[model samples]
Target: MKSTGFTLETLKAKVQALTRPERFVHILRVAELAQAIAEANGLDAQRAYLAALLHDAARDLPEEELLRLAPPENDVERSHPLAVHGRAARRLAEAWGVTDAEVLDAIEGHVYGVTPDNRIGMAVYVADVSEPGRGVNAEIRELALAGRLEEAYRQAIVSKVTYLKGKGVPVHPRTLLAYDAVLA
Candidate 1:
């Protein structure tokens, strides 16, 4: 609702307005981690934090509306339904008067995983996977605490890919590219 002052409360409000409670917690965690990564990468930490907090604002939308709202050329056209979050998020950003191109792009690109022209997007991308509550790779905590955040991210990505493969889910090409870039 309030777009002028980007406080944590405002971020939580924005996220809660659009997502479930559990999802809101993930956004908060990602926002915290995204801010840390932004600072480390010399980016606008505030912007990254806000972007991460709202990145999944539309992730749990109904499948039909999600498909209708997404861009036809979007990378997830043929893959998992979760890919629709990007296009939905971009539209929601515009509707909410989110002005910063970098922040909006961070939300739009959070699910796609390609190289971003802005550090805010990268921060959101990295934080989306590295957040603690995902519980996808809790064991990576050791490496993460050892100052190996990037390595932890790679291992997490590997675990995600392996899980997706086992479930017969088609892994997005962009995800694989991101994993390779991080591990390389």
Candidate 2:
């Protein structure tokens, strides 16, 4: 459980520099949500906050650049540019001197079609979906927040799968398996 030296100021600065004002606000919301989840789940609140803050550090990049840096194989289609942000975030975390293996791993798997095995990963995964103010239907988000975390995770995965399918995008085996591993 290595920890990064990312203080509140440093984390805020890093996000503000990388994300637009609106996006930074989203990050703030996610951070607060992560901290809340961490506290409720008896995990490290600060670490969870950092991981959520940096989760989208590079989410605004062009799809071409994202594909060039970390190409997802057939098992993981490159249909979503948002997926590439995880790779960019990894690079940003390293450059920012983030040494926490848990934090780095969480950020890396945040959108890499992988299920988180650690507490930190699980926390960020939930926080990413349950962040306040997302444009997702209010009822769905409320249902996700109103029950046990495992139940919420299951719903989130189903929501993600349904959304991707509706978009006519290829669903990655890892994503499906990851969700199943937690939900089932």
Where is model 1 poorest over a 10-residue stretch in terms of lDDT?
Answer: 1-10
Name model 2 segments beyond 4 Å from true: 4-6, 75-79, 112-116, 137-147
State each model's CA lDDT, in order: 0.71, 0.71
Q: Model 1, residue 183: displacement in angstroms? A: 6.9
**For model 2, how big is the CA root-mean-square deviation?**
2.8
Over 15-126, each residue of candidate 2 has an lDDT whose tens digit, in order, gives 7987888888888887887777777667888888888888888887667766665576654545555666776787778777788888887887767334635666666777
Q: Root-mean-square deviation of each candidate, in angstroms?
A: 3.9, 2.8
Q: What lDDT score is found at residue 131 in candidate 1?
A: 78
Top-TM-score structure, candidate number: 2
Task: Work out the TM-score per prediction.
Answer: 0.74, 0.82
